[model samples]
Target: MKLKVTGQNRGFSILVLVAACLLLLSACSSGGNGSNGAATSSQQSVANDATSGGSANEGAQSSEPVDIIWWHAMGGEMGRAVDDLVEQFNSSQEGVRVEAVFQGSYDELLNKMKASFGSNAVPAMVQMNEVSSRYMIDSGEIEPVQTFIDQEGYDLDKLEPNITGYYTFDGQLYAMPFNTSNPLLYYNKDMFAAAGLDPESPPQTFEEVYEAAKTLTKDSQTGIAIAISPWFTEQLFANQGALLVNNGNGREAPATESLLASEAGMKIMTWWKQMIDEKVALNLGRKTADTKKAFVAGQVGMIIDSTAGLKGIVDSVGNQFEVGTGFLPRPADGAPGGVVVGGGSLYILKDATAEQQQAAWEFMKFLAEPEQQAYWHIQTGYFPVTPLAYELDSVQQNMAEFPQFQTAVDQLHATTLNPATQGAVMGVFADARESVANAIEQVLTGAMEPEEALQKAAEEIQAQLERYNMTNG
Candidate 1:
């Protein structure tokens, strides 16, 4: 049977390598800070010994809690929220103890996973980035959450489909959606009104965005500032119902090609380049932080960024000017599409024993409960993956106060479910994103035309795909 939810209401606010990882977990566990750190072998032995050396009733009575390490990438305030959740789970029941260890950025964490693969010291649970799914699935080191869902007859109907869609591959759910977010068009209403544009009508298409930028460009303020990353390019493609990879975005089978040179891709690159040339759009380098700073400082009229930054941005903007939010700009003439989710999910590892695996599943289910999801959204800006969280009083109050929050949820629900929107999954996705970013830069700097740049990117990605499929085959 599942443990009951034990989270309390608060004021509307609320991995290491094998050897290196061992040191970190020992320190965390020793402190007894309730984060119960890594699953050290000695710790595992204690639990095992507790159940083995006594009478059946005595063994049952002396049942030691299963300890599981949760490797994560969230840091700063988000990292603290993670710690709080771990403590809550540790206190909620005696079945499992979760120790969450911050292991740097998503890329860094992925690198660490690669380094620790054969050591048998990998964590029992990991909060992996969305794009890392392809590689993780190929690694054969994870136990699909689908296994638990089927074993326990877990009903997935209560979870948000938009968030779950991205992790569902081969008719199986690979991970538990957590801390999900999407992109949003955030514009300064004051800037819009000053430009003689209707504040209520933010740009809805690329052309409209360009025109708005042109009108908003004057003095020190530009019309829009977007960090040129492959993510935005992917969003533009998905918004128009275009696939980034073949074979149903690798869901039907492992993808063999990247469609970065498709017509839709060309249009996106061309428009992005056109904006940079026209001087209305600010070509901030691939740091959304720089772009956000510009927007908050009132130097840019509009910007596009992850909904995960929604609360921070709004709070930073503070009473300086009103903020308006809209769906990520889509092509006016293209088929209906929607933005993809942009956060990590909790994954259970096969390195864990059966008991530890089930314990980890319980923790996953606890986090997905409506109350816990609402608390997560309240404590951090991450949108909830459980739709029922929206009905909670705290989340509703938050949405009412910051309608931009609602705009994000609405955009997600409004999206049409399709392979493109679910997004592309390829083993070298991280490398491919960098290649696409470089291709965009090449076009923006006039070193290559849109077609040539995208073609080059596609070729690089396809070549990598061939190698990855062969190696992992």
Candidate 2:
């Protein structure tokens, strides 16, 4: 394994950074309509063993209530839900008092954390995007939730395997998975019917999607509104059973290079370029918000977006059209792949007191409970990380009313676990996503051919990989 998260000592140097990438920024998550993850377990030692027997690790039993600061970056309805959860946790417990602080966006929060590293200003727990897994692992500022899991005897089985799989590394889980989401192919059912296509069936293959888009396109109305985002590209690569990086998606070992110029990448790039060239799809640049508005206004027939955006989009569309959700389109003749889990996870920071760490872990467990998970799933469009949440009345009722929200969960359940689906992890994911989006934009704008664009993107990402590894190596 490339990393280790073990030992009973509270705060040990798990990783040594050759250089600081503290100024490096990243976010691909919920509220942002996010990014899931995995990590390893090997012990240097277990000198100060903590909790046992499947209970909260109440960190040396403090005399005074432990005060812990939690930094999060969820805004609007999702932000309210987080505040509610935090309040519930705080009032429900007597030993720990949590002050939940809103930390702007993920990028801003990350930058703050980096800037505050090794300082007293860092919070006890932070909500981080899935893409930050590799960076977090290398930072040495986190206490692997695996430590708590080992001490508490937590049953991993009750949780969704796909989600756990993403966070589990070398038999150890890193961060506690929270607020999970995945991309979906959202189509206007009414538009489908008007176009003489079955409203119940959205296109399942790239070729089929193209044909459907072509048929749906008429004058100013395009079949789909596409935003040049790397999330969709990553989903497409997985959908076609391919990897975006080497070294088992930077698992098994740290990623040394990018695979953006591979056949899977080319196929997606070619398809994207072809759609624009044929005028069946509208390129709305890098902002998904723009494409989402176009779709909500019924200007576009279909779109691919995060499940986290489901409730807002549906509510916005209102009676204009019946919204339908479908699994992400794949290569018609290629091997079927799956979508990667997007969104953020809660991490226990090392700068915090042991009491604070224990409190944070307890809070994590509280959020993962079926009751809380169900409430969260409904409050935000993000699906529960645990399967038990699905059996609750809340989830069932919500699904019945807004059936479009069920597609992402259904799509996730049907996914076959593999490296492709587990997705990529890198310290420079923010820059990488931009590179991919820029490449697609260049192709669409005729600034460069698809082949040239992908090659340049690949090289740029490869450079990022080398820099990160060299700095953090």
Instruction: Count clashing residue pairs in model 1.
Output: 0
Model 1 lDDT-worst window of ten? 53-62
Instruction: Please list the C-alpha lDDT of all candidates, in the order they appear.
Output: 0.85, 0.83
Model 1, range 1-473, lDDT digits (tens) per residue? 96343354322222213667788878756733222234445444444442333223322232467778889999999999999988987876665678999999999998887776656677878899999999999999898999989976899999998889999987899999988888899999998998899999888998899899999999888888899878888888899999999998887899998899998898888787888898988888989999999999999999999988999999999999999999999767877888888889999877666657767787888899898899889888788888899988889899888888978888999987899999889899888998999998899889999999899999999999999999998
> What lDDT is reached at residue 231 by model 2?
88
Write model 2 residue lDDT over 1-473, tens digit each, in one string: 55455675324442333122332222111111100111101110011111222334423332345567889989988999999998887677556667889989989999998987787788889999999888888998999999988886899898899988888778879999898999999999998999899999899999999999999998667899878888889989998889999999888788878899888988988888899998999988888999999999888999999999999999999999899999999988778899999999989987766556776787788899999999999999998988999998879999999999778888999999899999888889999998988888898999998888988988998898899889986
Candidate 1 ranges beyond 4 A from true positions: 1-59
Residue pairs in collision within model 1: none
